[model samples]
Target: MHIGLISETFWPDINGVSMTLAQWSQGLLDAGDQLDLITPHAHADTVGLEGIPWQDAKPFRHISASRVPLPGYRGVKLGLMLPKAAKRLWRKSPPDVLYIATEGLLGLDALRYGRQNGIPVVGGFHTNFQYYLHHYHLQWLTPLMRAYLRRFHNACTRTLTPTQAKKNQLLRQKYHRIHRVGRGVDLSQFYPRTTQERSLWRQQHGISDDTLLLGYTGRLAAEKNLSQWIESYQILKSQHPSPVKALIVGDGPWRDHVLSALPDALWLGELTGEALAIAYSAMDIFSFPSMTETYGNVVPEALASGTPVIAFDCAAAHELLQPGKNGDCIGVNEAEDYTARLIHLAHDYQQSPQRWRTASAKSIHHLGWPTVNASFRRHLVQAIHEVKRHGRQRSDFVATKS
Candidate 1:
């Protein structure tokens, strides 16, 4: 099968959607399927991201769209390809299915072209753009944005979200044919380090082995609710009996702001491959305070590395966090509750480190990439079959008229 993936984000962009697409595309390629990636041209500065096998001179085709820097977030770009441009690229060798992974203009053009040409199109709900409006001082646009998103996804053959909670939420908002498609972490790539290795890593970072190292991975954006993350860490550092330090991974438009607030934190900007694994393994606990996520991939990645997480009860946290076992999930937008839970978890870790470590490592062992990719492939295939069935019905009606 041939698949065309349309997204504003792709490999080399340090975000969940980019990473997830890279993994899924690799799975499709391994299963003997052809792919064409449609995304914004990678900027000259977008280097040192996790390398993908197919990013350069790989089997799949690459198509670049016209792009502009997103307002207020110069580090990210939005893409758009005109309808004629899309047609010219796919006139002879169009894909069997089209996956629209972002709701930007690029994806909008792809959806229009796919529908006009009778190609199957599937949508992915990866980010909460509406919730982000509040952070950007555009809360007045929330209802309009929500309506536009509903219309956009509803036009697709099916809309796939990363968690059941999101699917239920979209369904409540009158979305059609919503499906839950979860993500997976690479067990081999994100497992826990040995005791000695963890100790050595902490030593290298100027941290004592016994000190509690709290970490936060992913973009340091306003939507991530990072102010609260900083507040929680400050509270812990001041009051906790054990020494507490923070490790900040990844970078974004909010980099300067985060650095200003956390001058003492160890800032490891945008690591991938083995280095990222070590960052996760080196931490004693992980905090992901973002309530505005379709699914927080960092939560699982941290869990896979034996780092228990404290997050809001939404997205991937709602599905993966086992409260007392793996980590704790606070109520959505409950700032005080989030800080309390993080402190409580830290105390629990001090009491019984082995229990937390074992459970965190074992909790997500079932979420292998192969299983997740296979299920996603099946969904895409089903969309193609549905299009074919509809085509056959239309042909039969014409034949009866003749």
Candidate 2:
């Protein structure tokens, strides 16, 4: 089946959504499904990627707001994608399925085109635009963001979410055709028992053996609730005479601010491939404060790499984190409690290494990309069947009237 995937983010810009889409596209291509991806051509004239298979890529009209940097992620842009751009490029090659990923302008445009043209439209929740408002002190806009999100996802034939809690939340909002599309992990890339790797990674970053390495990955911007992290770290420092070391992977607009906030932390800018893998393996504990993620991709990645995670009770924590099994999920917005957990973990760093490694390894198996793709394909096929059943039902009613 041919499927057209549209989003506001793509490669050359590596975030969770972009990477997840790329992996799913590869898995679909392997499954012999043709994919035509509609995304912002942020970098014009960009060509084939390295080590990745050949794929079709297209660009759309970039809005003035399109180029604006996400407050937390310096590398990614937050803009409305013009659906007309999808229309111009995809009208001829429209797929049996039109999968929309983001809720920005481009997504709306794609939804409009899909509805008008009678193509099956499916949406997947990738980011949390509402929780972001709280980080930036725009908490009052919660209703607007929720309404916008509900309207967008409701338009799809089905809305795919990674967690059960989110599914319930969306259902309450009256979102249509909501379904749980489980995510998978690349187990080969991340595993435990890398002592030398941990050593090398630590030495490379000047993290001594006695120093507790608390790693946090993702954008360094405001939406990630990074101030909470810093405050937590300070709390750790105030109690413990020895300062715990922090390793921040990934880059964003907040990089400069992060430096100003905590100049002493080890910053590896944006890392990928084996480098990212080793970074994950070396951390004693994983702490992520960002509520803007529908699913925090790095949480699983960290787990697979054998590091235990610490996140608030939301998003990926609700789906992937199995409380004491894989990682710890702090109470909602309980930054002090979040900090205390990390501090407690840091004190017992030596004891946690093996337990966390085992937990991480166990959680990784559930998220195989091939498995996720198969289930998703089934959902699409089922949705199409439902549409057909409804169409035939309508036809029979008209025949009876005649």
Candidate 3:
């Protein structure tokens, strides 16, 4: 099938949406399908997408849409609508399916063109924009955001969510044709490191073998609920007798806040590829306090690296984590409970480190990128069939009316 994948976020943007969409694009191409990647032209120079196998061997096109800096977001841009450009692109060679990965201007334009031209469109619900409102002091926009999201997604043949919990939430809000396509971890790239390698990593950071290293990976932003993470870490260190150190693995607007609050914590900035995997492997415990994740990719990456995770009981944690097993999931918004869990986990680590590591690795062993990519392909096929069937029915109805 010829697929057009549209999103404001793509390569060079170090976020979940961009990474996942890039994987999906390669998956479609590997399956002997054509893909036209429609995204903003931001960070064009930094887009190191040549490493994707399909991009080197298959028929793939990129449509660069105009973009401007997104308001209130540091180093982030929003794609502008270009309906005329979209029409021209599709007029020459229309896609068999349109996958809208975001509800941004670019996605809306693609959705409109797909609808007008009778092309099947599948939307992806990747981010919790409604939850992000409170962080940005735009709580009043919650209702408006919800309404817009509902209308935008409902217009598509189906909307794909990254977690079952998120799909259920969308269903409760009256979202139609919702489907769950959870994210996956690249096992080859994010696996546990050798003991010597892990030791070297700790040594580089001036961390001793006895010290418990707590890690958090992802954007250090307000929407991530990072303040709570720092508070929990501080509480854990205070309560525990063991030497505790923290490693924050991403960069964002909240850098200053994190630095001021946790002065001794190692800020590794943004890391990718093997370096990121090594960081995950080096951690004894991964604490993710974010409450707004659609599906925390870092959670699985940590688990894949044999590192126990502590997270709020939502998103991927709600789905993948089992209390007292691979990791602990604190109740939603229960800050005290979250901190308590962190302390408890630290104690458990001191008791039996090997057992915790084994459990963590075993829990997420099934999450491979190949499996996730196949599931996504199936969803696209289903959306295409639904659209074709509906079109046929409409044609028959019109003939009967005539």
List the candidate numbers ranked by TM-score, top first. Answer: 3, 1, 2
Give the lowest summed-lDDT range of ten residues in model 3.
Answer: 393-402
The C-alpha lDDT values of all candidates are 0.85, 0.72, 0.83
lDDT of 2 at 340: 76
Candidate with more favorable, higher TM-score: 1 or 2: 1
Clashes in model 1: which pairs? none
TM-score, one value per model: 0.93, 0.86, 0.93
Q: Pick the candidate with the highest lDDT.
A: 1
Q: How many clashing pairs in candidate 2?
A: 8
Whole-structure CA lDDT of model 3:
0.83
Question: What TM-score should be assigned to candidate 2?
Answer: 0.86
lDDT of 2 by residue, 217-312 (tens): 887778888888888876776686465777889776678877787777888888877788888888888889776678888888888888888888
* Candidate 2: segments with Cα more than 4 A from true spot: 42-75, 78-91, 241-243, 322-325, 392-402
